[model samples]
Target: MPYYENAIKKMLPKTYLRQHVAHEIYVALTHFQSLVPMMDKYVYNDGTMKNLMSLTGTIPVMFEDNTYNIPVCLWIEESYPQTAPICYVRPTCEMTVLSGKYISSNGEVMLPYLEEWKNGECDLVSLLQVMVVVFGDFPPVYMHSHPEPEQAPCWLQFHRQAEVLSRTDGSLYLHLASEDDLPFQQENETSC
Candidate 1:
Protein backbone atom coordinates (compact mmCIF):
# COMPACT_ATOMS: atom_id res chain seq x y z
CA MET A 1 0.00 0.00 0.00
CA PRO A 2 1.05 3.61 -0.56
CA TYR A 3 2.06 5.77 2.37
CA TYR A 4 -1.23 7.66 2.40
CA GLU A 5 -3.26 4.49 2.20
CA ASN A 6 -1.23 3.07 5.03
CA ALA A 7 -1.72 6.18 7.05
CA ILE A 8 -5.45 6.07 6.47
CA LYS A 9 -5.57 2.41 7.49
CA LYS A 10 -3.65 3.11 10.67
CA MET A 11 -5.87 6.05 11.54
CA LEU A 12 -9.12 4.14 10.87
CA PRO A 13 -9.34 2.93 14.48
CA LYS A 14 -8.72 6.42 15.81
CA THR A 15 -11.07 8.96 14.19
CA TYR A 16 -12.57 9.92 10.84
CA LEU A 17 -10.59 13.16 10.95
CA ARG A 18 -7.25 11.43 10.75
CA GLN A 19 -8.41 9.48 7.74
CA HIS A 20 -9.08 12.76 5.98
CA VAL A 21 -5.66 14.05 6.93
CA ALA A 22 -4.04 10.88 5.70
CA HIS A 23 -5.91 11.14 2.42
CA GLU A 24 -4.79 14.70 2.03
CA ILE A 25 -1.21 13.77 2.67
CA TYR A 26 -1.47 11.03 0.14
CA VAL A 27 -2.93 13.35 -2.45
CA ALA A 28 -0.28 15.97 -1.80
CA LEU A 29 2.48 13.42 -2.04
CA THR A 30 1.11 12.01 -5.27
CA HIS A 31 0.54 15.36 -6.90
CA PHE A 32 3.83 16.85 -5.80
CA GLN A 33 6.07 13.89 -6.37
CA SER A 34 8.20 15.91 -8.75
CA LEU A 35 8.67 18.50 -6.09
CA VAL A 36 9.55 16.19 -3.22
CA PRO A 37 11.44 12.96 -3.15
CA MET A 38 9.71 9.84 -1.89
CA MET A 39 12.16 9.66 0.98
CA ASP A 40 14.19 12.31 2.74
CA LYS A 41 17.44 11.22 4.32
CA TYR A 42 17.42 14.10 6.77
CA VAL A 43 13.78 14.52 7.71
CA TYR A 44 12.85 10.87 7.27
CA ASN A 45 15.90 9.50 9.01
CA ASP A 46 15.31 7.04 11.83
CA GLY A 47 15.99 9.66 14.47
CA THR A 48 13.64 12.15 12.87
CA MET A 49 10.93 9.53 12.45
CA LYS A 50 11.33 8.62 16.09
CA ASN A 51 10.94 12.23 17.09
CA LEU A 52 7.79 12.60 14.99
CA MET A 53 6.36 9.43 16.49
CA SER A 54 7.10 10.78 19.94
CA LEU A 55 5.25 13.96 19.08
CA THR A 56 2.26 11.96 17.87
CA GLY A 57 2.21 10.12 21.17
CA THR A 58 1.97 13.25 23.29
CA ILE A 59 0.59 16.19 21.32
CA PRO A 60 -3.12 16.39 20.51
CA VAL A 61 -3.42 13.98 17.63
CA MET A 62 -6.97 14.89 16.76
CA PHE A 63 -7.58 18.13 15.00
CA GLU A 64 -9.65 20.34 17.28
CA ASP A 65 -12.84 22.03 16.14
CA ASN A 66 -11.93 25.67 16.57
CA THR A 67 -11.22 28.72 14.45
CA TYR A 68 -7.84 29.05 16.13
CA ASN A 69 -6.87 25.42 15.74
CA ILE A 70 -4.18 24.90 13.11
CA PRO A 71 -3.84 21.47 11.52
CA VAL A 72 -0.24 20.38 11.46
CA CYS A 73 0.40 18.98 8.00
CA LEU A 74 3.71 18.08 6.36
CA TRP A 75 4.44 18.78 2.70
CA ILE A 76 7.56 18.68 0.59
CA GLU A 77 8.20 21.19 -2.15
CA GLU A 78 10.95 21.54 -4.76
CA SER A 79 12.82 23.65 -2.27
CA TYR A 80 13.43 20.74 0.07
CA PRO A 81 17.14 20.45 -0.55
CA GLN A 82 17.68 24.21 -0.76
CA THR A 83 14.97 24.81 1.83
CA ALA A 84 13.11 23.01 4.56
CA PRO A 85 10.12 20.75 4.21
CA ILE A 86 6.98 22.86 4.11
CA CYS A 87 5.11 22.25 7.31
CA TYR A 88 1.65 23.68 7.04
CA VAL A 89 0.02 24.90 10.21
CA ARG A 90 -3.64 25.35 9.39
CA PRO A 91 -4.73 28.96 9.90
CA THR A 92 -7.47 28.02 12.31
CA CYS A 93 -5.21 28.70 15.25
CA GLU A 94 -4.44 32.21 16.24
CA MET A 95 -0.68 32.77 16.14
CA THR A 96 0.61 35.40 18.50
CA VAL A 97 3.32 37.69 17.23
CA LEU A 98 5.84 38.15 20.03
CA SER A 99 7.00 41.56 18.93
CA GLY A 100 5.31 42.70 15.73
CA LYS A 101 6.48 40.47 12.90
CA TYR A 102 3.84 38.37 11.18
CA ILE A 103 4.43 34.78 10.02
CA SER A 104 1.84 33.27 7.78
CA SER A 105 0.18 29.95 8.52
CA ASN A 106 1.67 28.38 5.37
CA GLY A 107 5.24 28.45 6.79
CA GLU A 108 6.70 30.58 3.99
CA VAL A 109 9.16 32.52 6.16
CA MET A 110 10.24 29.42 8.02
CA LEU A 111 11.33 27.75 4.76
CA PRO A 112 13.68 30.62 3.96
CA TYR A 113 15.10 30.69 7.46
CA LEU A 114 15.73 26.96 7.31
CA GLU A 115 17.31 27.30 3.89
CA GLU A 116 19.64 30.04 5.05
CA TRP A 117 20.76 28.05 8.05
CA LYS A 118 21.19 24.86 6.05
CA ASN A 119 22.92 26.47 3.06
CA GLY A 120 25.25 28.36 5.34
CA GLU A 121 27.22 25.09 5.36
CA CYS A 122 25.57 23.79 8.53
CA ASP A 123 25.55 19.99 8.42
CA LEU A 124 22.40 17.99 9.11
CA VAL A 125 23.59 17.12 12.62
CA SER A 126 24.48 20.71 13.32
CA LEU A 127 21.19 21.87 11.78
CA LEU A 128 19.26 19.44 13.94
CA GLN A 129 21.27 20.59 16.96
CA VAL A 130 20.37 24.20 16.28
CA MET A 131 16.75 23.23 15.65
CA VAL A 132 16.65 21.43 19.01
CA VAL A 133 18.19 24.39 20.75
CA VAL A 134 15.88 26.93 19.13
CA PHE A 135 12.65 24.93 19.04
CA GLY A 136 12.96 22.91 22.25
CA ASP A 137 12.28 25.72 24.68
CA PHE A 138 10.25 27.78 22.14
CA PRO A 139 10.28 31.14 23.84
CA PRO A 140 6.78 32.62 23.64
CA VAL A 141 8.15 36.09 23.14
CA TYR A 142 10.08 35.18 20.00
CA MET A 143 7.19 34.56 17.62
CA HIS A 144 6.11 37.84 16.05
CA SER A 145 6.79 41.53 16.47
CA HIS A 146 5.31 44.87 15.44
CA PRO A 147 6.55 46.31 12.18
CA GLU A 148 8.62 49.48 12.25
CA PRO A 149 8.30 52.46 9.97
CA GLU A 150 9.87 52.04 6.57
CA GLN A 151 11.36 55.53 5.96
CA ALA A 152 11.30 56.62 9.62
CA PRO A 153 9.90 60.00 8.43
CA CYS A 154 13.38 61.63 8.77
CA TRP A 155 16.72 60.03 9.67
CA LEU A 156 18.27 62.90 11.67
CA GLN A 157 15.20 63.51 13.85
CA PHE A 158 14.69 59.77 14.29
CA HIS A 159 18.28 59.26 15.44
CA ARG A 160 18.02 62.17 17.87
CA GLN A 161 14.92 60.69 19.43
CA ALA A 162 16.44 57.22 19.35
CA GLU A 163 19.58 58.51 21.10
CA VAL A 164 17.52 60.10 23.82
CA LEU A 165 15.50 56.97 24.29
CA SER A 166 18.67 54.87 24.48
CA ARG A 167 20.02 57.11 27.24
CA THR A 168 17.07 56.46 29.55
CA ASP A 169 15.56 53.22 30.90
CA GLY A 170 14.16 52.34 27.49
CA SER A 171 14.69 48.63 27.68
CA LEU A 172 11.14 47.95 26.55
CA TYR A 173 11.43 50.41 23.71
CA LEU A 174 14.82 49.05 22.76
CA HIS A 175 13.54 45.51 22.87
CA LEU A 176 10.80 46.35 20.37
CA ALA A 177 13.00 48.58 18.28
CA SER A 178 15.05 46.08 16.30
CA GLU A 179 14.26 42.65 14.88
CA ASP A 180 17.86 41.57 15.49
CA ASP A 181 17.67 42.25 19.27
CA LEU A 182 14.00 41.44 19.90
CA PRO A 183 14.96 38.44 22.01
CA PHE A 184 16.67 40.75 24.52
CA GLN A 185 20.03 39.28 25.50
CA GLN A 186 21.33 39.06 29.04
CA GLU A 187 24.90 40.21 29.76
CA ASN A 188 25.57 40.59 26.01
CA GLU A 189 25.18 36.90 25.22
CA THR A 190 24.94 35.87 21.53
CA SER A 191 22.84 32.77 22.07
CA CYS A 192 19.22 33.43 22.93
Candidate 2:
Protein backbone atom coordinates (compact mmCIF):
# COMPACT_ATOMS: atom_id res chain seq x y z
CA MET A 1 0.00 0.00 0.00
CA PRO A 2 1.12 3.65 -0.58
CA TYR A 3 2.44 5.81 2.30
CA TYR A 4 -0.72 7.90 2.82
CA GLU A 5 -2.95 4.85 2.67
CA ASN A 6 -0.71 3.13 5.18
CA ALA A 7 -0.56 6.28 7.36
CA ILE A 8 -4.35 6.36 7.67
CA LYS A 9 -4.59 2.60 8.06
CA LYS A 10 -1.78 1.92 10.54
CA MET A 11 -2.38 5.10 12.58
CA LEU A 12 -5.79 4.05 13.80
CA PRO A 13 -6.79 0.93 15.77
CA LYS A 14 -6.72 -2.10 13.49
CA THR A 15 -10.41 -2.74 14.20
CA TYR A 16 -11.49 0.83 13.27
CA LEU A 17 -11.15 1.13 9.49
CA ARG A 18 -13.77 2.25 6.96
CA GLN A 19 -14.08 6.08 6.64
CA HIS A 20 -13.06 7.10 10.15
CA VAL A 21 -9.25 7.68 10.01
CA ALA A 22 -9.13 8.51 6.32
CA HIS A 23 -11.94 11.03 6.71
CA GLU A 24 -10.18 12.76 9.59
CA ILE A 25 -6.86 13.01 7.72
CA TYR A 26 -8.62 14.37 4.67
CA VAL A 27 -10.44 16.97 6.70
CA ALA A 28 -7.34 18.13 8.59
CA LEU A 29 -5.27 18.63 5.45
CA THR A 30 -8.13 20.28 3.61
CA HIS A 31 -9.05 22.63 6.43
CA PHE A 32 -5.50 23.60 7.49
CA GLN A 33 -6.04 27.15 6.15
CA SER A 34 -8.52 28.03 8.91
CA LEU A 35 -6.41 26.63 11.75
CA VAL A 36 -3.22 28.73 11.34
CA PRO A 37 -4.08 32.41 11.17
CA MET A 38 -0.69 34.12 11.21
CA MET A 39 1.04 32.24 8.44
CA ASP A 40 -0.49 31.01 5.23
CA LYS A 41 0.15 27.26 4.77
CA TYR A 42 -0.29 26.07 1.22
CA VAL A 43 -0.60 22.29 0.90
CA TYR A 44 -0.25 20.33 -2.32
CA ASN A 45 -1.44 16.75 -2.34
CA ASP A 46 0.61 14.48 -4.59
CA GLY A 47 -1.24 12.24 -6.99
CA THR A 48 -2.23 8.70 -5.95
CA MET A 49 -2.40 8.30 -2.12
CA LYS A 50 1.13 8.76 -0.82
CA ASN A 51 -0.08 11.25 1.84
CA LEU A 52 2.92 13.45 1.05
CA MET A 53 2.45 17.21 0.99
CA SER A 54 4.53 20.31 0.14
CA LEU A 55 3.77 23.27 2.38
CA THR A 56 5.02 26.84 1.93
CA GLY A 57 4.60 29.87 4.22
CA THR A 58 5.99 33.32 4.97
CA ILE A 59 7.37 33.76 8.48
CA PRO A 60 8.20 37.17 9.96
CA VAL A 61 11.79 37.73 11.05
CA MET A 62 12.48 38.56 14.66
CA PHE A 63 15.74 40.45 14.06
CA GLU A 64 14.19 43.37 12.20
CA ASP A 65 11.19 44.43 10.15
CA ASN A 66 11.59 41.69 7.56
CA THR A 67 9.95 38.42 6.53
CA TYR A 68 11.17 35.10 5.14
CA ASN A 69 9.30 32.68 2.98
CA ILE A 70 10.15 29.08 3.83
CA PRO A 71 9.22 25.90 2.03
CA VAL A 72 8.35 22.97 4.28
CA CYS A 73 7.69 19.45 3.09
CA LEU A 74 5.77 16.90 5.16
CA TRP A 75 6.37 13.20 4.76
CA ILE A 76 3.82 10.97 6.46
CA GLU A 77 5.25 7.66 7.60
CA GLU A 78 3.37 4.50 8.49
CA SER A 79 3.75 5.38 12.20
CA TYR A 80 2.45 8.93 11.86
CA PRO A 81 0.34 10.53 14.65
CA GLN A 82 1.99 8.06 17.00
CA THR A 83 5.09 9.45 15.26
CA ALA A 84 5.25 13.10 14.21
CA PRO A 85 5.25 14.05 10.56
CA ILE A 86 8.79 14.34 9.13
CA CYS A 87 9.14 18.07 8.34
CA TYR A 88 11.99 19.58 6.30
CA VAL A 89 12.69 23.27 5.59
CA ARG A 90 13.70 23.92 2.03
CA PRO A 91 16.21 26.57 0.90
CA THR A 92 14.94 30.03 -0.06
CA CYS A 93 16.45 33.34 -1.15
CA GLU A 94 14.88 35.36 1.65
CA MET A 95 16.47 33.27 4.41
CA THR A 96 20.16 33.24 5.20
CA VAL A 97 21.57 29.70 5.53
CA LEU A 98 22.71 29.08 9.08
CA SER A 99 22.34 26.45 11.84
CA GLY A 100 21.61 26.92 15.54
CA LYS A 101 19.81 25.38 18.54
CA TYR A 102 16.52 25.37 16.63
CA ILE A 103 17.53 24.84 13.01
CA SER A 104 20.25 23.28 10.90
CA SER A 105 22.13 24.67 7.87
CA ASN A 106 20.26 22.14 5.74
CA GLY A 107 16.94 23.69 6.88
CA GLU A 108 15.99 21.09 9.49
CA VAL A 109 14.09 22.52 12.46
CA MET A 110 14.18 21.01 15.99
CA LEU A 111 10.86 21.84 17.62
CA PRO A 112 10.13 20.73 21.20
CA TYR A 113 6.40 20.61 20.49
CA LEU A 114 7.03 18.09 17.72
CA GLU A 115 8.56 15.71 20.23
CA GLU A 116 5.44 16.14 22.38
CA TRP A 117 3.12 15.89 19.39
CA LYS A 118 -0.26 14.48 20.45
CA ASN A 119 -2.67 12.91 18.02
CA GLY A 120 -6.04 14.69 17.52
CA GLU A 121 -4.91 17.35 19.98
CA CYS A 122 -2.15 18.67 17.71
CA ASP A 123 -2.35 19.39 14.01
CA LEU A 124 -0.04 20.63 11.23
CA VAL A 125 -1.33 24.16 11.74
CA SER A 126 -0.14 24.16 15.36
CA LEU A 127 3.17 22.70 14.30
CA LEU A 128 3.50 25.46 11.71
CA GLN A 129 2.97 28.08 14.40
CA VAL A 130 5.81 26.65 16.45
CA MET A 131 7.94 26.47 13.33
CA VAL A 132 7.38 30.16 12.66
CA VAL A 133 8.41 31.14 16.18
CA VAL A 134 11.56 29.04 16.11
CA PHE A 135 12.51 30.47 12.77
CA GLY A 136 11.87 34.01 13.96
CA ASP A 137 13.85 33.75 17.18
CA PHE A 138 16.93 32.48 15.37
CA PRO A 139 17.30 34.99 12.59
CA PRO A 140 20.00 34.72 9.93
CA VAL A 141 23.29 35.97 11.36
CA TYR A 142 24.23 37.21 7.92
CA MET A 143 21.35 39.66 8.04
CA HIS A 144 23.18 41.62 10.72
CA SER A 145 25.94 44.05 9.67
CA HIS A 146 28.83 42.25 11.33
CA PRO A 147 32.44 43.22 10.72
CA GLU A 148 34.67 40.91 8.71
CA PRO A 149 36.42 38.17 10.69
CA GLU A 150 40.04 39.24 10.05
CA GLN A 151 39.39 42.96 10.36
CA ALA A 152 36.83 42.68 13.19
CA PRO A 153 37.17 45.11 16.11
CA CYS A 154 38.48 43.88 19.49
CA TRP A 155 35.03 44.06 21.07
CA LEU A 156 33.36 42.34 18.13
CA GLN A 157 35.88 39.51 18.35
CA PHE A 158 35.20 39.22 22.06
CA HIS A 159 31.47 39.15 21.35
CA ARG A 160 31.86 35.94 19.32
CA GLN A 161 33.65 33.92 22.04
CA ALA A 162 31.84 35.42 25.04
CA GLU A 163 28.58 37.18 25.77
CA VAL A 164 28.57 40.89 24.86
CA LEU A 165 25.33 42.23 26.19
CA SER A 166 24.14 45.69 25.12
CA ARG A 167 21.66 47.65 27.21
CA THR A 168 20.57 51.27 27.54
CA ASP A 169 19.50 51.62 31.16
CA GLY A 170 21.86 54.46 32.10
CA SER A 171 24.68 51.98 31.47
CA LEU A 172 28.33 52.54 32.34
CA TYR A 173 30.81 51.05 29.86
CA LEU A 174 33.93 49.43 31.27
CA HIS A 175 37.00 47.85 29.66
CA LEU A 176 39.94 46.23 31.54
CA ALA A 177 42.47 46.09 28.72
CA SER A 178 45.14 47.88 30.76
CA GLU A 179 48.87 47.42 30.11
CA ASP A 180 49.76 49.23 33.36
CA ASP A 181 49.06 46.08 35.41
CA LEU A 182 50.19 42.54 34.61
CA PRO A 183 47.69 39.80 35.44
CA PHE A 184 48.36 37.98 38.81
CA GLN A 185 51.64 39.89 39.40
CA GLN A 186 53.26 40.85 42.70
CA GLU A 187 52.35 44.40 43.78
CA ASN A 188 56.06 45.40 44.15
CA GLU A 189 57.20 43.66 40.94
CA THR A 190 58.23 45.87 38.01
CA SER A 191 59.03 44.94 34.39
CA CYS A 192 62.63 45.73 33.37
Candidate 3:
Protein backbone atom coordinates (compact mmCIF):
# COMPACT_ATOMS: atom_id res chain seq x y z
CA MET A 1 0.00 0.00 0.00
CA PRO A 2 2.95 2.35 0.76
CA TYR A 3 6.37 2.79 -0.86
CA TYR A 4 9.94 3.30 0.36
CA GLU A 5 13.27 3.32 -1.55
CA ASN A 6 16.90 2.79 -0.60
CA ALA A 7 19.06 5.89 -0.36
CA ILE A 8 22.06 4.06 -1.81
CA LYS A 9 22.69 1.91 -4.90
CA LYS A 10 24.68 -1.30 -5.28
CA MET A 11 24.57 -4.27 -7.62
CA LEU A 12 25.79 -6.92 -5.25
CA PRO A 13 25.06 -10.57 -4.67
CA LYS A 14 22.05 -11.57 -2.61
CA THR A 15 23.16 -11.88 0.98
CA TYR A 16 22.01 -11.31 4.54
CA LEU A 17 24.37 -8.46 5.48
CA ARG A 18 24.21 -6.39 2.29
CA GLN A 19 22.83 -3.35 4.09
CA HIS A 20 25.95 -3.16 6.23
CA VAL A 21 28.30 -2.87 3.24
CA ALA A 22 27.21 0.04 1.05
CA HIS A 23 29.95 1.23 -1.28
CA GLU A 24 29.91 3.18 -4.58
CA ILE A 25 26.24 2.35 -5.03
CA TYR A 26 25.33 5.72 -3.62
CA VAL A 27 27.96 7.39 -5.73
CA ALA A 28 26.87 5.54 -8.83
CA LEU A 29 23.20 6.35 -8.32
CA THR A 30 23.91 10.00 -7.60
CA HIS A 31 26.29 10.25 -10.52
CA PHE A 32 23.67 8.78 -12.86
CA GLN A 33 21.12 11.14 -11.34
CA SER A 34 23.31 14.16 -12.07
CA LEU A 35 23.66 13.13 -15.71
CA VAL A 36 19.99 12.39 -16.27
CA PRO A 37 18.47 14.74 -13.73
CA MET A 38 15.33 15.23 -15.75
CA MET A 39 14.64 11.56 -16.32
CA ASP A 40 12.23 9.86 -13.98
CA LYS A 41 13.75 7.56 -11.34
CA TYR A 42 12.21 4.11 -11.54
CA VAL A 43 12.08 1.68 -8.68
CA TYR A 44 11.50 -2.04 -9.09
CA ASN A 45 9.62 -2.94 -5.90
CA ASP A 46 12.35 -0.76 -4.38
CA GLY A 47 12.43 -0.40 -0.65
CA THR A 48 14.95 0.41 2.02
CA MET A 49 15.17 -3.28 2.82
CA LYS A 50 15.15 -4.43 -0.82
CA ASN A 51 16.92 -1.96 -3.08
CA LEU A 52 16.63 -2.46 -6.82
CA MET A 53 18.15 -0.94 -9.93
CA SER A 54 16.84 2.44 -11.05
CA LEU A 55 15.79 3.15 -14.64
CA THR A 56 15.87 6.55 -16.33
CA GLY A 57 15.27 7.65 -19.94
CA THR A 58 15.96 6.39 -23.41
CA ILE A 59 19.45 6.60 -24.91
CA PRO A 60 18.46 7.70 -28.41
CA VAL A 61 20.63 5.97 -31.00
CA MET A 62 20.49 7.58 -34.42
CA PHE A 63 22.13 5.02 -36.65
CA GLU A 64 22.91 5.69 -40.30
CA ASP A 65 20.29 3.20 -41.43
CA ASN A 66 17.82 3.24 -38.54
CA THR A 67 16.91 5.00 -35.31
CA TYR A 68 16.53 3.57 -31.81
CA ASN A 69 15.72 5.34 -28.59
CA ILE A 70 17.00 2.54 -26.42
CA PRO A 71 15.72 2.63 -22.86
CA VAL A 72 18.41 1.87 -20.27
CA CYS A 73 18.16 0.11 -16.90
CA LEU A 74 20.68 0.16 -14.04
CA TRP A 75 20.74 -2.19 -11.09
CA ILE A 76 23.18 -2.70 -8.22
CA GLU A 77 23.62 -6.16 -6.73
CA GLU A 78 25.05 -7.54 -3.51
CA SER A 79 28.31 -8.45 -5.28
CA TYR A 80 29.09 -5.11 -6.89
CA PRO A 81 32.59 -3.79 -7.73
CA GLN A 82 33.74 -7.40 -8.20
CA THR A 83 30.65 -7.72 -10.37
CA ALA A 84 29.54 -4.71 -12.36
CA PRO A 85 25.92 -3.73 -12.64
CA ILE A 86 24.21 -5.43 -15.55
CA CYS A 87 23.15 -3.07 -18.34
CA TYR A 88 19.83 -3.87 -20.00
CA VAL A 89 18.80 -2.46 -23.36
CA ARG A 90 14.99 -2.21 -23.29
CA PRO A 91 14.06 -2.25 -26.94
CA THR A 92 10.64 -1.29 -28.21
CA CYS A 93 8.49 -3.17 -30.70
CA GLU A 94 9.39 -0.66 -33.38
CA MET A 95 12.99 -1.84 -33.33
CA THR A 96 14.19 -4.63 -35.64
CA VAL A 97 17.34 -6.64 -35.14
CA LEU A 98 20.37 -6.01 -37.38
CA SER A 99 23.52 -7.55 -35.89
CA GLY A 100 25.15 -8.29 -32.52
CA LYS A 101 25.24 -11.59 -30.61
CA TYR A 102 25.57 -10.11 -27.13
CA ILE A 103 22.15 -8.49 -27.45
CA SER A 104 19.02 -10.52 -26.78
CA SER A 105 15.29 -10.47 -27.31
CA ASN A 106 14.71 -10.01 -23.59
CA GLY A 107 16.85 -6.83 -23.67
CA GLU A 108 19.76 -8.53 -21.90
CA VAL A 109 23.14 -7.23 -23.04
CA MET A 110 26.37 -9.20 -22.58
CA LEU A 111 28.84 -6.41 -23.13
CA PRO A 112 32.57 -6.83 -22.61
CA TYR A 113 32.76 -3.51 -20.80
CA LEU A 114 30.48 -4.78 -18.06
CA GLU A 115 32.09 -8.19 -18.25
CA GLU A 116 35.47 -6.63 -17.50
CA TRP A 117 34.32 -4.25 -14.80
CA LYS A 118 36.78 -3.78 -11.94
CA ASN A 119 35.16 -2.49 -8.83
CA GLY A 120 36.49 0.76 -7.27
CA GLU A 121 38.67 1.15 -10.36
CA CYS A 122 35.82 1.61 -12.84
CA ASP A 123 33.00 4.15 -12.89
CA LEU A 124 29.48 3.72 -14.24
CA VAL A 125 29.88 6.70 -16.56
CA SER A 126 32.76 5.10 -18.37
CA LEU A 127 30.80 1.87 -18.64
CA LEU A 128 27.83 3.76 -20.04
CA GLN A 129 30.01 5.55 -22.57
CA VAL A 130 31.46 2.25 -23.58
CA MET A 131 28.00 0.75 -24.03
CA VAL A 132 26.91 3.64 -26.23
CA VAL A 133 30.07 3.46 -28.28
CA VAL A 134 29.70 -0.27 -28.69
CA PHE A 135 26.10 0.20 -29.69
CA GLY A 136 27.32 2.51 -32.46
CA ASP A 137 29.82 -0.10 -33.59
CA PHE A 138 27.16 -2.85 -33.75
CA PRO A 139 23.84 -1.10 -33.85
CA PRO A 140 20.47 -2.86 -34.17
CA VAL A 141 18.28 -2.42 -37.21
CA TYR A 142 14.90 -0.65 -37.18
CA MET A 143 12.07 -0.96 -39.65
CA HIS A 144 11.58 1.95 -42.02
CA SER A 145 7.86 1.42 -42.04
CA HIS A 146 6.13 4.59 -40.91
CA PRO A 147 2.57 4.22 -39.73
CA GLU A 148 1.68 7.80 -40.55
CA PRO A 149 3.93 9.27 -43.19
CA GLU A 150 2.43 12.75 -42.92
CA GLN A 151 2.76 12.84 -39.14
CA ALA A 152 6.36 11.74 -39.09
CA PRO A 153 9.00 14.05 -37.61
CA CYS A 154 11.78 15.59 -39.65
CA TRP A 155 14.66 13.45 -40.91
CA LEU A 156 17.05 15.22 -38.56
CA GLN A 157 15.21 13.72 -35.58
CA PHE A 158 16.41 10.28 -36.66
CA HIS A 159 20.02 11.52 -36.79
CA ARG A 160 20.58 13.61 -33.70
CA GLN A 161 22.74 11.45 -31.45
CA ALA A 162 26.06 12.94 -30.39
CA GLU A 163 28.52 12.68 -27.53
CA VAL A 164 28.24 16.38 -26.73
CA LEU A 165 24.46 16.31 -26.62
CA SER A 166 24.46 13.19 -24.43
CA ARG A 167 26.47 14.95 -21.67
CA THR A 168 24.29 18.04 -21.55
CA ASP A 169 21.46 18.13 -19.02
CA GLY A 170 17.75 18.44 -19.88
CA SER A 171 15.77 17.46 -22.97
CA LEU A 172 16.90 18.50 -26.44
CA TYR A 173 15.10 18.55 -29.76
CA LEU A 174 16.28 18.62 -33.31
CA HIS A 175 15.19 21.90 -34.85
CA LEU A 176 15.71 22.08 -38.59
CA ALA A 177 14.66 24.63 -41.22
CA SER A 178 10.97 24.29 -42.00
CA GLU A 179 9.23 25.28 -45.18
CA ASP A 180 10.19 28.92 -44.57
CA ASP A 181 13.85 27.81 -44.55
CA LEU A 182 14.65 29.88 -41.46
CA PRO A 183 18.04 29.51 -39.84
CA PHE A 184 18.21 27.45 -36.65
CA GLN A 185 18.93 29.86 -33.82
CA GLN A 186 18.10 30.06 -30.12
CA GLU A 187 16.13 32.99 -28.85
CA ASN A 188 17.50 35.53 -26.28
CA GLU A 189 16.20 33.26 -23.53
CA THR A 190 18.84 32.14 -21.06
CA SER A 191 17.27 28.74 -20.33
CA CYS A 192 16.35 25.77 -22.55
Q: Which candidate leads in lDDT?
A: 3
List the lowest-lDDT window of 10 residues for candidate 2: 33-42
Where does candidate 3 have its weakest 10-residue lDDT segment?
A: 1-10
For model 2, the superposed segments whose C-alpha errors exceed 4 Å read: 1-63, 93-96, 140-192
Looking at model 3, the pairs that clash are 9-25, 10-76, 10-77, 11-76, 11-77, 12-77, 12-78, 12-79, 13-78, 13-79
Candidate 2 on 1-192: residue-level lDDT in tens?
445545654444443432444554545455443221111243434634443333443443444566655555555444555667666665443335577876667666667887788887876656766776677776533433554555655454445332233437744333232232233333433322
**Whole-model lDDT, model 2:** 0.51
TM-score, structure 1 vs. true: 0.24
lDDT (Cα atoms) of all candidates against the true structure: 0.34, 0.51, 0.52
Best by TM-score: 3
Q: How do the residues 86-149 of candidate 1 rate in per-residue lDDT, one tens digit apiece?
A: 4433322234422222234333224334556454353223333343233333321222244346
Q: How many backbone clashes does candidate 2 have?
A: 1
